[model samples]
Target: MDEMMPHSHLPAVGVADDEPSLAGVIAEDVAAWCRRLSSTLLEETGESLLGKLRAEADILRTLVDGEGSVVDGQPQAPPYRDRKGRLRNQTNPVTSARNPVAPPMALVGSDGESEFSVVLPIQYQGPPKTLHGGYVSVLLDETMWHAVRTALDGISFTRELTVTYERPVPLGVPLTVRGRVTSTDGRKTFAEGEVLAGGEVCARASGLWIAPRR
Candidate 1:
């Protein structure tokens, strides 16, 4: 068990909590507990405790306000919506507490390459102590397309996405995500991405992005 005692030396999730970013961070923290509750229920919760959790969840659901559309100028994209300064944006299901797939928190960072990192937690597990394949695919696809928004002009949509799992990505670890432009043919943009854990590649993806006529 100690071998999987978590990568104790990993850096903390790096995100600033400015006035604009506060809400997103709060949501991330809350989502984390949701993940914990889910996994715990699967492992050790009994019927009584499960009922209590359901009641609590229902209460929270009632409190939730409906989501509105993105503002006039903000980029409207799939997988997540772009917010001015929020890391855990309410508009983004990947980082939103209200969404089932969101991790507790993910830290976005760059290393002189066209890539970012989202710190994952145990809540996003599939195989024991490993990240789920579906989440991995989305992470690569969304991140790659998001990266494309910067590299190309006009709104781009994911025409195709291909993901290859290199290794088992550990839960509760920082994963480096990168998407880079390889070339372009007319309105088509070609990009490639990879996810790395502890400096080792875990997944790779190639995507085709297109600018559809309005």
Candidate 2:
């Protein structure tokens, strides 16, 4: 609705091949198409296409069980080292390219303040054409965490978070996210974040974080 911020443009889904696994990007494309298919009317051709895709998925399921850990017979992702030899989480529900459910909110800037943006697709919808309230809170919490991480220069865990929903966030629109540190008290840090859509504040959140001792 309103003009997007400078440098806030998100890259096309599945185009993020810079991450460790090319398969992750490919999976993002597949997941996106699956979401599109969910919103489409199924005709004869569509049903036939689904059959083919199911067959291929069965093959993939067999091939992937070897990589990650198994718990209760389900494979779980494990942390892996990146090109720089830094260990990275296997998947992050908010920002990891490997997780299909992620709006994969992108961080654009963190110079004293943190800024992120995401375009929620059909899969993230709750009530007609609006994003799920839970996800709005997730974005706010994550943005606040980034604000604390950047400002405090260390890892911290959220102690408490409070969110207020001001308006319904629509699906398929770019939403601006912003967060900043409000103050610090010894090991405790405080921050707030807001999600804006169409130039209006759709939701706001404030959080307290506890930084681990160095």
Clashes per prediction?
A: 0, 0
- Give the TM-score (vs. native) of candidate 2: 0.67
Q: Give Cα distance to truth, residue 179, candidate 2, Å.
A: 0.8
Report the Cα lDDT for candidate 2: 0.68
Please provide, for model 2 over 1-214, each residue's C-alpha lDDT reduced to its tens digit, 9 standing for 90 to 100.
1221111012122233344343443454454445445544222257777786676566456435433323224112333555565655445667755455566677865654798988887667789899899999888877877887777765677788889999999888899989999999999889999999988999999878887677
Number of clashes found in candidate 2: 0
Clashing pairs in 1: none
Please list the C-alpha lDDT of all candidates, in the order they appear. Answer: 0.60, 0.68
**Over 4 Å off, model 2:** 1-89
lDDT tens digits, residues 33-120, model 1? 4666776665556787778688757645542321232223232211222334333323344544444455523434332125566776
Minimal lDDT window, size 10, model 2: 1-10
